[model samples]
Target: MRIIGLLLLTGSLTMGLAACGGGDEQSTAKQEKAVETSTEAKAGVEEFTITAKNWNFSSDKEIVVKKGEKVKLNLVNKEGLHTIKNDELGIDLTADKPAEFMADKTGEYVLKCSTVCGATQDHEGMEISLKVVD
Candidate 1:
């Protein structure tokens, strides 16, 4: 009779522990998902669109953004195919794809056309500036 009572107690304890462990695992998963959602919401992004034409960019000559902010740059080719690149900021903008990065450094970055589309002077003069401020 004593052995029977001990066995019942042990079985009940084991079942209780299993239930608690499963609940804890589910709770942990929910907490992790909430943290991920909060982090994504905290990350702010800034987007800018620049249009390129035959000889120059039709949009603004300079783009300004805050340091440490995420930047999304879109290049729209209105007339011809062109490519712009900046080694310092690791920016490569083309008519096919866009560029995205964090503006961590505060300075002036010059983005120039890397593709030869027309005359030397036109390609040489085609450029834009990106300014990151505090």
Candidate 2:
């Protein structure tokens, strides 16, 4: 019984010592690096607000963006779940929270709601034209 008690006391002390070591310094350094990287990546983005209702998009109904510019497309849903997809940019954004995409090409791309909803916005076929100018 005395040997068992000694072993338990030693094990507890070893674990306590390990927990008090400087592992938190490494964790804090990594977190700071990640925040810096994210800030730099979003430094020069041109932001826009897009509102999605039951079957349509409001506030900048059609997008006219400049090519080679980083666009931050912010989407707000007020009615239901909506999806905006652009085939050229390979974007399929869901309207749950805010979202963003880059405008890098100079041409016309078809934008539309990919959500299958009720009999509004032309029966779930609401569309928008995105024209990127050089």
Candidate 3:
């Protein structure tokens, strides 16, 4: 009866190993699908919004972006005569309209107000910085 018990044990071990292999294959497939989904999400267009308040661009702060990434910048101005421009980077935000720019290089860029709506200081002279990274 010892030989019979040994045979049963070996058979169960073989079946268990086969089941584990199948489970691993399924897990690997699921992992690949998850990776693909995340990549697609990241590749999708990204957007950022900046609002103008009073006589200055509200929350005039630094914006960071990755190199080779597409960015959609929406500028919302409560004031009728405000403009956003980054001449060095060829980005311009006109009055009553939104502006868009893509990050092609990795560096820091200063964004300034183009329209001289008020004193070029305080809120009028406000500026922001943007950092682009790879």
lDDT of 2 by residue, 1-134 (tens): 99999999999999999888877466545644543455467778755555667767765445787888776565555567677777778667664444466787789877678787567656455766667899
What count of clashes does model 2 give? 0
Q: Which of 1 and 2 is ahead in TM-score?
A: 1
User: Could you say which candidate leads in lDDT?
Assistant: 1
Total clashing residue pairs per candidate? Answer: 0, 0, 0
Tell me the spans in candidate 3 whose CA falls farther than 4 Å from its real position. Answer: 1-43, 59-62
Q: Give the TM-score of candidate 3.
A: 0.57
- Could you tell me the lDDT of residue 36 within candidate 1? 48
After aligning candidate 2 to the native by TM-score, how far in Å is the CA of 9 from where it should be? 53
TM-score of 2: 0.57
Model 3 Cα lDDT, one tens digit per residue, 1-134? 99999999999999999877866457545644543454466555455556565565654244778988776555655554567788767788753354666789899987777767666565455666678898
